[model samples]
Target: MPNPQLGATSLLTLLIFPDVKPDNILVDWELDEQGNQTVKEVALGDFDLSLKLIDNQPLRAPHAVGNVMWRSPEGQSGKGVAKPSDVFSFGLVCIYGLGGGDMLILDAATIKNLKDHGMPAEQEIVVRHFLYFGPLSQGLLNHVADETWHTLFTSAGSIAEEEAIDDPDARFERWPKDIAPHITPEAKDLIIKMTHLDPAERATIDEVLEHPWWSVGVHNG
Candidate 1:
């Protein structure tokens, strides 16, 4: 067998298969590097620059600085329709990489508490939080739960409001507010376009990378 080849930079990309168990999707990735210097099963870039297609859902982790990885389910018809369902999951990834709060952590906490005492709606709220705000952002946790999400959303018509006013030419401007603040106003607008509640309004991976944020960073490589 051929030995694994290393890269010029401390980076490598993996494409996970949808049917593969999340824990087992490591074949395409190299985990032997010292300190795991490269990223593990998570997003590590700012924008969705690479396009990975899988046959099943991928597990997710919360975000931190300097993480940018993204995945999407297969097509839109037949079995592929389920692929789009994975879009929601991938959306959460975008949020995390963008520095959105540890929502899965918060959601798990919320669920455990509810199991001991609250109503079903409490859990629903968190789920909705994921469905709505989970995608398109990695920093919403700081803003949404800041005792100011409502205020900010209302005032800004989503975080992109301010960003849109400034750039006027960004793509994320149309993305839903649920996940916009992690990026700059310009980036925020691009995210807005990606998270448009109407999936039709969202940007495809090909288009997303063409946005300013990715363009500025891509050349650095």
Candidate 2:
């Protein structure tokens, strides 16, 4: 299915959306022995499945901030969940759902190598972020708080000579054109903004809802 159709359908079906990850969103379909088929959305618990309302503030799962979830650097560094974080994960889902699997910049072997060399799984995931979505801006780099920043930057620099296409803009320009042919330019633009490395720089859900891709007659009713 085209991502816009899937995204729009999801939004319409789930009145309150949270933790927008692929695993949380399911496709319900079945085929009978007589060849009849049925498909529908199945509700899984409450709208806030992975969230907890504490003192009226929501606390989301920390483990969700990784390869599949697409949290910003600050988020991974413990800034906690916000709407922008959800936007980042939603963009990841949209890109991967719309035939953009090959756009994932890291392969399993690289991840394994990092782990074998003593990088923690969480830090390894962050390193992959830098590899895929960096050379970080000076402002973003300065904002990075922990030792993970130094580790990620040093690892990125070490690979720079071997990785010719290190610029995020360069990679972004080539990504949808090559891997996700089904994605429109406007959709790509939305995804790029939504998945920005800085949470402050990422698009809000309201902005995403207003993006042209959602209203361009490309999605299903």
Candidate 3:
């Protein structure tokens, strides 16, 4: 039934059956209360749906209904999950979120090259500035220039400069402080660990769980 407190009213009702030729179907329902709407769980053979009702309005379009047969471990009946598929999906989501869905890290490498040359340093500086904003992929730049690693660190405060090159934890220096609130501490820790230029020194997932941000509940969600 619809919760009267939320001011919602169902205007229609529907039922679903898997064995049915059309697979999907719709039906009409009546509402006894003024402007009252409620959702009722209904099971029809291999399918399931919610039936609801709305106030006395003209009977218009039919409501949509779908079937549900199998049930997964989480009680989701439509689809099943495989361990390998789940792992693969997690990897994809991680890549998409970190790189802003952009696959061009080539620009990043180009800027690193320009910093290698002796021309005005500001040009390379601009590239490195945006690198941390997302993952950089191949062929994103207009030209190839000599760029250096130090150019990426130009914004480094004195503390960053002193420890960045030598410390395993220095990748945190890449993040701008202004966006700190937007980043959960666990995420920050993961980014720091994952972005380590020296892959050998990066922190593992188990290690990241012990980070201050994760320990304090920032990653609970």
Candidate 4:
């Protein structure tokens, strides 16, 4: 049920889903009579973790959800979840789908290995972000309630140059290259915009919808 506290809703009304991985989202296609498919709609499910801000209050607290692979960097930190968390997760889902079911560093086997390492799985995922996206901002790092994470990054929120090692995976950097098929630059740019390491820097849901990638027309890929 929709929260009564939300009262009337408009295009600008904001709601946060603490978990927005692909598992919680569904897409439907408008099929033609000739047995062809056309994507027409997307539905968000599993509102058990859905969140709503009341009276302009900020959302803060531990999250309850699964699927560490798709969770946002900020959510993994102690900053609590926000709308950008959903954007980050959704951006990953888009990457997964667009890349033809492969995002090298984010594969299940890697996440399982991290889970088995007896540390927070997000720690390694954060490392991948640092390597690929440059660095986490101090403003973003300040939200981390855990002091241990401080040792892994520099004062500028970047991995130390001497200790840094690139993943060399078939991800954003390899898009439209030999590792990836003919994915468009517009597509790559949109995902980067949505998945900025700093939650505050992530594109809003509206901005993502308005991205030029959507204008390129859908391809089966």
Candidate 5:
């Protein structure tokens, strides 16, 4: 039986529209060699048992050059980590979870190699990011810190100055085709909004929650 605490009142509700609450959103955990478990919830605010309510705040952290796949373009380019960066990571998670994992630029074999061996060269990761996101716009590129811009474009050979042209339409057009036959149109729209190349243009968490994709299976009954 589905747990009512998980936000579904009945089997029908579980099949239709299931609420995703922060109480159920596991942030991190550690498993001991003895099979002990330590879990950490992403609790930013109060959790009221009386109402089963959670007031969550956007999690923030200083940007770090690790986990190339989950890092946003701005993060890779040395921008400070913020809520929008989390949105980008969430988009990647959605893509992977929605049977579009193969759409990413990094192949399974390469990923396995990296995991078994060690971190791939930074330049290799940058190249993969370029292949995944295409070229960045000139305005966005200019906004990136000087050292990061120079490293990605000059040292890493991931981008060229001539490639920095604005073509927002192409960006949106390319992603859907890459992940087609698996993802719904609504999922694609939400992913695009969540993963906008420019952090300022990325959708907020509230917007993501309100997207039509979340309502696709909802029923009035």
Candidate 6:
């Protein structure tokens, strides 16, 4: 028997693309002799808003960068972005990919309407986020620190739903019809973990890539 040698260990570099959407992801597909399509390689691009953190701490920016419709709570807050920010954005990208672009935490049309009506879409988006990922925890709301959210939600982590705005036409209509039953448990777990409302609670991007969903072959179950 031959002995196996240990190679150099890969170091963890906390990098944040801050913006991860379907448009930024590049995938190269290959077809085998049997005409089976396989993923040759996958790459991330549009690093104009990308950042590499020296430590695991959040990277604060002057203004809100990244795609508006696909930004993480922290990133959009104009405060800072961390590994969990990337996890949340990429998690949404995964949802969009799996659902064939059907899942959107905040749709552009809704945002446009809110802006047109002199309403901060952040409030509505918060409402949609609560519907999609569950209510915003006190820790998350405190971190984001949006004025409207702080006013609408109490320090006890309860939101005043009566005062919140909503998109009557598309308030999570796709959740039950396009998600839930269609997504695998492993995938759902990973995505939910990645998209945890609290950055402190969400898994790091490293943990996301190393999740069992990628290794267990339980995606169909």
lDDT against the true structure, per candidate, is 0.36, 0.56, 0.30, 0.61, 0.51, 0.62
Candidate 5 C-alpha lDDT tens digits along 72-116: 665565453455665676677666656666544477787778777
lDDT (10s digit) by residue, model 3, range 1-221: 22211221111122111122112322234555696543443212323332222352211122211211111111111111122111222222233334322321225555567666753333332222223322222211211111332333233223344444454332333444342444554555555454332222335333443456534533342
Candidate with the larger lDDT of 2 and 3 = 2
Residues 1-221, model 2: lDDT tens digits? 22334345455332324455566666777888999755544433335534433453323344443433345555565434555556777777777767775554347776588678986555554554555555554545544534555566556544642353545433553453556767777777788788776666878777887788776723521
TM-scores of the candidates are 0.38, 0.63, 0.25, 0.74, 0.54, 0.74
- The most accurate candidate by lDDT is 6
10 residues in a row with least lDDT, candidate 3:
67-76
Clashes of each: 27, 0, 24, 0, 0, 0
User: Best to worst by lDDT, what's the order?
Assistant: 6, 4, 2, 5, 1, 3
Question: Which parts of model 1 have CA positions greater than 4 angstroms off?
Answer: 1-87, 103-107, 117-127, 130-182, 217-221
Per-residue error at 101 for model 6, in Å?
3.1
Candidate 1 root-mean-square deviation in Å: 13.1
Model 1, 1-221: lDDT tens digits are 11222231123224322221123223334556574433323322323323354543322323111111222211111122222223333444445546554432346566577677854422333233334332334233222233333343333334443444554443333344454446455555455455443343456544554567654522222
- Cα lDDT tens digits, model 4, 1-221, are 12211221242256777676777766666667898876655677777766577764545555523356776766655354677777788777777666634542456667687678875556666665555555556655665544554555443244422234444342355444554454567777887888787777889877877776776624413
Model 6 clashing residue pairs (backbone): none
TM-score quality measure for candidate 5: 0.54
* Residue-pair clashes, model 3: 24
Model 6, residue 61: distance off in Å is 3.0
* Model 1, global lDDT: 0.36
lDDT-better candidate, 2 vs 5: 2
Which regions of candidate 3 deviate over 4 angstroms?
A: 1-174, 177-181, 215-221
| Residue range with the least summed lDDT across 10 consecutive positions in model 6 | 1-10
Among residues 3 or more apart in sequence or in different chains, the pairs in candidate 5 whose N, CA or C atoms overlap within 3 Å are none
